[model samples]
Target: MVGCDDQMERLLEDLTQYSGSSRERKFIRIIGMRGIGKTTLAKKVYNKADIRSHFDFRAWAIASSQHNVKKILISLLRSPKGDTFYIEDEADLADMVQKSLKGKRYLIVLDDIWSTKAWDDMRLCFSSENNGSRILLTTYNSEVACSVGTENLSL
Candidate 1:
């Protein structure tokens, strides 16, 4: 939240824009070195009053270097509701995530991503059907940011 007003405003504008004109899903990548406030800014934007009301659902997931797909999916799925269920298969977990977010406009924040592979694996769970759904990610790697085809904020 320190000296991030401009960046925060830009991100909020991007996030709240109408995406109905296209079928592609929108992604925002916040990139910065460790000890910077990348995650802090994302959390502030994600929890804003306007941001909360703009989407039907909101989920926050932390992706560490290990990149466990199942664990990530489960964390995302459980965020909307406090449901506790065990799904041992990755495909099933992906399906559940897809189903839960199929027709709903959602705001999902993937924090601390280490690689593009993690983004690729998680991207499959989202459907791009003109739903104004957005995926916000924070990473330290420029390569991962570039792979996702989006301009990232370097802090």
Candidate 2:
């Protein structure tokens, strides 16, 4: 943690600024090896400061070695967001998630992603909304991080 505390803090600040910006979409992907605290950092950031004073809605999904977009989406949807649950397929779940996230500055965190396909499918749920909605994705693959970010992530 000490290795990049300042840098992480600065990045968090920049994201906070973007959260309030009346501009484009803001998507952030945080990647690192398993047990290296990517999930921990994402949780702390989402609950404490990252979503503070900015995000109108917040959702998190845990994608382990399995890829069940429907179940994950149902979990987040049925949370405090007041969304309903269903046994729909991935496409339907994705549509619900997208609708629930629309027009709101949301912080959608997908933790412990194991496959690129899961990210690809879930990405359909998020839209720019012009409210600077942010996506904080955590994975162990450098490619996944790079695919969703302008630069690679390491810790």
Candidate 3:
């Protein structure tokens, strides 16, 4: 770890281990109550890491208590993911996001999700044939993480 802060140090370690060694496509939820630094920690790892160059592409989606699938897909497709840019409809956006992710390893941050459906709808986009992609999901619900999979890159 490169910081004097112990919490930051621990976060650094966890991010390094997960991104470097975890081969399977993963969903990590930083579960905590409000103001517990879940988003802060995930942001630190996202901003101050060498993982970007390690992966083929990096994208971020800002989820809310109420979110539409097209909005999320549009945001995730903004980065260099090789996906066609059409987000007027939910089906079109989802298909483009999935098609663009083929053969590429991606690091996607699904921040501030509130339900399992968010993961369910978007899981197909991250589940690549190559199997080297990763999705970092930050939420306040443990059940959301567990519902997706127990094997998570949790904060």
Candidate 4:
């Protein structure tokens, strides 16, 4: 955690702020080259005691290079609740995710996203109803970070 205190504090401030007046959902992206500590920083924030108490639901998923929408949704869904059944259809899976996250304040960490398409595909499942929900991700590509349309921190 050396040299990461500042970054962690900044991210924590942004994440824990009140967004009650904003209609849009908040997203935080941590971008950096390989071997940097983007994932570590995200985990540190994700596991924080304040963060855990702030959000009603919390989920963590690894996007890696190959992004599987179903698997990601399943992981997200399972985090707040327990295990969920396997659904064959993509739409059904997405609908399930949306339903699960619908009125709850959630913090989802998407680690190692490799592409904008992956983010776009998964973003549909999260409903932005001015509920102060947040999606935080770590990525190697700056383009991917920018495409998320929110504050991005470079490590």
Q: Give all TM-scores, in the order shown.
A: 0.94, 0.84, 0.79, 0.93
lDDT of each: 0.87, 0.73, 0.71, 0.87
Task: Return the candidate ranking by TM-score, descending.
Answer: 1, 4, 2, 3
lDDT for model 1 comes to: 0.87
Off by over 4 Å in 3: 1-22, 80-86, 152-155
Candidate 1 per-residue lDDT, tens place, 1-155, comes to: 66888999888987888655763568888989987999999999999999999999899999979989988998999987878769899999999999989888999999999998999999889887787888999999888899877546667
Off by over 4 Å in 2: 1-4, 19-22, 81-84, 151-153
Instruction: Give the residue spans of candidate 4 off by over 4 A.
Output: none
Error of 3 at 100 (Å): 1.9
RMSD of each: 1.6, 2.6, 3.7, 1.5
Judged by whole-model lDDT over C-alpha atoms, candidate 2 comes out at 0.73
Q: Model 4 over residues 111-152: C-alpha lDDT tens digits? A: 999999999999888888887888999999988988997787
lDDT score at residue 99, model 3, on the 0-100 scale: 74
lDDT of 3 by residue, 26-118 (tens): 555677786667777777777764776676777888887887788899888885544556447888878877777777777788888888887
Q: Give per-residue CA lDDT, model 2, range 66-146, as digits (tens).
A: 878787788668765566665657777778778888888877778887777877867777887677667777889876776
Output the worst ten-in-a-row residue range by lDDT, candidate 3. Answer: 11-20
**Model 2 reaches what TM-score against the true structure?**
0.84
